[model samples]
Target: MLAAVFHENGGPEVIRVEEMDAPRPGPAEVRIRVEASSMNHLDLWMRRGLPIEIPMPHIGGSDIVGTVEKCGAGTVRSLLGKRVVVDPSLDYDWYRLARLRGYDGEPFRVIGEHTQGGFAEFAVVPAANVVELPDGFPAETAAAAALAGVTAWRGLMTRGGLRKGDRVLITGASGGVSAMAVQFANEAGAEVFAVTSGSENVRHVRGLGADHVFDRTTTDWGREIHRITNKRGVDLCLDSVGEAIWPQLLRALAVRGRLVSFGATTGPAAKVDIRLLFWRQLSILGSTMGTPAEFRDAMDMVFRGKITPPIHAVLPLHEARRAHEMLEAGEVFGKLVLDPREARP
Candidate 1:
């Protein structure tokens, strides 16, 4: 099996394609013949040196769509040969407890963070993490859609508690997760507002049902958001830009509104006035990836075309380095996919 492995954390050049032994499933696990996988910002974080170092020669990817080649002994026998998408969150068992109390047992044990991930032709995952893909579903779309979609779904529906007639603001609208957030908020009958840097993506975000699009490059977006809502601000603000937008987003939130965040793509540190929180009665919620059930529920909408994946580019697995570079350079409008079959000899 050919896999992309990085021995040192640095730049995209560190990632190399090489022949590696195919992984075998353990009991309660399944070996997937990986057909398609997608890149995420998490992959970039793993590629660079984070506080926690992955094992040297690590493979990085989370979103995967494949067919079960074999099930481990004592695993459900019926899963073999089934097409499936993997929930990359490894904490399937503790998700309930975590959601109830905000307890993520250990930060480093996430898939592609601690263990090997789906960057190769063959990958092994727990059977419980597999969500059966509908027949005739496009594997590329499924792979490109799962992780980001699930993150947005959980953040909006479960954490943010978004409801009909609510106004929601999503920062960084061109990214995969924010694009999904825009669509999910709109489909829930909420008015969607998007802040994007590029004018080209304004129409794209609008096509996803965003009621208002702010050009962050040209406008003081938070003030525009306030004006659009008649100074009431939004009921929810989904912010991932971190410090760069934190103060502005806090100012843009309606009284008692919630702010849900999943990642800090820019930088994490933020300085906030205590008065804002106390006076506005604001709720700040941090979300990671979704639970297995949430992942399945989100993918259902994706498969049914109620929301569609926005693919920026698709490359062969050997081109994984270039894909990572594109993501790091912020050149992609949406998710970038890798086709393992194209890279095989």
Candidate 2:
């Protein structure tokens, strides 16, 4: 077996493809022959080194679509030979208790960030994490949808309280999660506003059902949305860009409106105006990945064809370094997939 891994973190160039021993499933786990895996911004963060400890020579990928090749002790035998997509959000005992109590648990950390992930010929996960894929479904598409789709669904519907006829604003609309947020909000009958880095991304974001697309390079999107909505502002705003645009998002929200954020791609520090927060009576909510129920609901819509995330490119596993470069440079509009079967001999 071969895996794309980095012994030490710094940049994309640190990632390399090397022959490695295949992983085996543990009790209650299943081994997946990874067909396709997708990249998330988390990958970039991990590669650049976060504060958490990582296993040396770590493989970083969270969104995985694969076939069950073997089942380990106490695993359900029926899952063997099935094609499935793994929910990258690992669950814990306290998480279930928190969900039952209607609170968000400090979630078990993400797969690739804290555990070995799917950038390999084979990976192991708890069998309970696998979601069966319908026959003939494109594995690459499922892989692309796994993390971003779930994150958007939870951010907008669960945290943002998005509903039909709501006016929604999504910042950094060209990335995977933000693009999915646009489509999901649109399908829910919201009037969707989007912000992108340039004219090229504006066109792409518009194609994803954004009612209006503003180029961040030239437009003050907050003011534009404010004017467009006749000073009422948007009912909801979903932001992933973090510090770079948080202040603007505050100005773009309607009175008592909610802003749900899942990531801080542009660095975490942000300056907030205390007056605007109190005067508007706004809700600024933080969200990470979805709860188990939310994950199921989101993937159900995905597997049923209600939403399909765009795939910017499908590269071989050996090109993982180049893929990371593209993602880090903000050159991709959607998910970049890796086919482990394409690894060199």
Candidate 3:
């Protein structure tokens, strides 16, 4: 099997495609012939090293779309030969309990981060994490939407409590998650405000249904939103551009409004004003990937064409290094996909 892997964490240059023994499924697991996989900022972060330990010589794609090649002991037999997409968020029944109490006796594990991932011709995951895809669904689209779709759904809908007619702000609007959030918030009938770097992305986000798209390179989006809304701000602000933009995001929320964050693409240190929390009665919430049910809803929406995430490009799996370069350099407007069939000899 050919896989994109890195032995040590550094930059995108560390990633390379190499032949490795195919992974076999364990009990309650299934091995799939990987048809397609997509890139995420998570892949870049893992390649650059996070605070925690991870499997070295690691394959780093989390959004997997494949066909079940075999099922392991105790796995459901019917799953064989079905096309599936994986939920990268790997937790358990204790997940809800642990989250409610902020317990972490057992830290959460993601597919590509903790174990081997699906950036290869063959990969294995728990049968429980695989959801069958409807016939004729595009593998590239499914792969592109998997992780980003679920993340946006959880952040905006579940944690942020987004509702119809609500005014919503999505920061870093060009990102996969934020782009998806724009469409989801639009589909939910929210008035969307978004921020991106250039004129082109501003237009792209606007086309995705953002009522207001600000080019961050030339505009102070926070001030613009507050002024346009007559100082009322928005009902919810979903942001991943932490630290540098956090203070502005907080100030751009309506009184008693909620702000939900899922990532810190910018530096992670942000100065927060404790007075604002009480003075404005604001809620600061942090969210990661969704639960099992939310994951299903996200994929179901994609399968039904309820929301469509743009695909920037689809490249061969052997071009993983180049794909990483493209993503880290911030050159892509939407998700970048990899097709394993192109990688085979």
**Per-model TM against the reference:** 0.96, 0.96, 0.97
lDDT of 3: 0.91
Clashes of each: 0, 0, 0
lDDT of 2 by residue, 1-345 (tens): 999999998988899999999988899999999999999998999999998897778998998889999999999899999999998988645555776876665657777778899999999988988999999899999999998999999999988899999999998898999988999999999999999988889999999999999998998777888789999999899998999888888888899989898888888898889899999999999988887778889888888888889899999999999999999899999889999999884
Top-lDDT candidate index: 3
Best candidate, TM-score: 3
Q: How would you order the candidates by TM-score, starting with the best?
A: 3, 2, 1
Candidate 1: C-alpha RMSD after superposition: 1.9
Kindly indicate the candidate among 2 and 3 with the higher lDDT. Answer: 3
Candidate 2's TM-score reads 0.96
**Model 3, 1-345: lDDT tens per residue?**
899999998987898899999998999999999999999999999999999888889998898999999999999999999999999888754577686877856667888888889899999999999998999899999999999999999999999999999999999999999999999999999999999999999889998999999999999888899899999999999999999888898899899989998989998898889898799999999999888899999988899998888899999998999999999898999799988888864
- In model 2, where is the ten-residue run with the lowest total lDDT? 90-99
lDDT of 1 by residue, 1-345 (tens): 999889898999999999999988898999999888999999999999888767678988788889999899788989989999988888665756767768757542566667788888988888988889989899889988888998999999999999999999999999989988999999999999999887888878898889999889988888888888899999998988898889898999999999999988889898787799999999999998777788888999998899987999889999999999999888888799988888753
The runs of at least 3 residues in candidate 2 whose Cα sits more than 4 Å from the true structure, single-residue gaps closed, are 92-107
**Alpha-carbon RMSD, each predicted model:** 1.9, 2.1, 1.4
